[model samples]
Target: MTSVSSKKCNKEEYSFVYGDEAVSYEVVRKPAVEGLSHQKSQRKIAIKVHPSCEVVVIAPEDTEREDIHKAMMKRAKWIYDALKEFRGHLEHVQPKQYVSGEMQFYLGRRYVLKVVEDADALPSVKMTRGKLLVTLTRFNDGKTSMVRTLVSRWYKARAERIFHERLSELVPHATWVEGIPSFRVLPMTKQWGSCSAKGSLMLNPHLIKAPKECIDYVILHELCHIAEHNHSEKFWRLLTSVMPNWKEVKSRLDGLAELYLNE
Candidate 1:
């Protein structure tokens, strides 16, 4: 989820007005590769819109500026549509205020958060009477740092336990995996889970807010990476073999990601 755009020294920047919006984009020239033929070297211009709303154009070195502009203009509508979608996602994932009556999620279920001030009670968090209750011995209604801390800790603990349990159930189906690969629970802004080159996995704690099947989909996804590191055809094939309807599950997860990845 954390994507840091690389700074390119040799790049050209341009901006054009599209309706009421002024769109900015950069073009990075691509050098001809050694193995590529002359015709292949004249590659078509490639346009990419990043999650951070960065628009980048990759083009052959010999491509004229005017030609690049034409290509960009042709895709301007698509680019703007993509940008609007990501911007909406960013706006939706705002930080929580942790108010007593605020709603919270767990395992795809909603719970009303109730902060209770009990001078003699120890600080604790628990689900009681269908509510996520936070008991504070030294509660201050004005400051909610303690509430945030307690709720986050509880989420991390549950994520660690549930993620491991789901991984266990799905790993047996991933015939390529050796054993239960080590994994860590962490908070990520834009990723549900990832598999490292060393086969270790990182699952976002917020993902525990999703349903059990969704969690299994993410775990199975990383497990597929153990054998096929890159997202090549084989990688996707391996994933589909294990979870036949993975595409449907993935789309369902994508539809609910904005809600689940909340603070």
Candidate 2:
């Protein structure tokens, strides 16, 4: 394999020839694993293909280029398959207009938007009779921006409450976790949830649009990170010990991303 490094890029991204094809992937340097040589670390090189077909390779800072290239080649088929599937999903994603009659998702169920004009009532959003009802005062015009803001605020509020509840319910399963980690709900582009070494958890507010089972999967996944920091075999074992059906739940959660992630 031949590698061509990019000098102008801020990130450590490179283009390489794998077989007859040339591909570009971002390189992220991570801390080296303890008790293992630089080259022999099992996670010295790890690959992730995002829903946008962006490829990233995480490696130890001291790892050689040859090791990264070899690892990428070993996962060539899986990478191509993932890219193809992501491309298919992208083709069907239409931009939302935030208009009346538009479809919205909450907790794995679809709800139709119903906008109403109420001169005496304050602008608000709520679910009534299986549909999302947005009541606005006459002083405010029913613009897309106004509608989006109302809906976004509603989702954020619900996400905060639901995420906390789910975390509390699942904490009992993960006995390794000592104290409850503080959590915040925010918008994230590339991940469902993340945990910091300082015992803080950040959850993607968009996850509220997915099913309860899928939401639980994300919470449990981050909780496992509290005990195991990296995506090592031990991390998977700890996660499996808590939720045996996490694999199936994770697959379903991945499939729901295209529907919720508008941008």
Every candidate's lDDT: 0.83, 0.84
Highest-scoring model, TM-score: 2
TM-scores for every candidate against the unseen true structure: 0.64, 0.66
Candidate 2 per-residue lDDT, tens place, 99-212, comes to 778778999998998888898899899998889998878534546778788999999999999998998889888898876779999899889999999868999988999999
Q: Whole-model lDDT for model 2 versus the true structure?
A: 0.84
Q: Which stretches of candidate 2 lie over 4 Å from their true place?
A: 1-92, 139-142
Tell me the tens digit of each residue's lDDT in model 1 across 1-263: 11112245665777766667877888789887778786767657888876677888998898777777788778878988988987876676767888788878889888989988899898889988879999988756545999989999999999999998988888888877888999999899999999999999999999888888889989998898889889999989988898889887886678667767776
Which residue pairs in candidate 1 have backbone atoms (N, alpha carbon, C) closer than 3 angstroms, thus clashing? none
Sequence-dependent TM-score of model 1 = 0.64
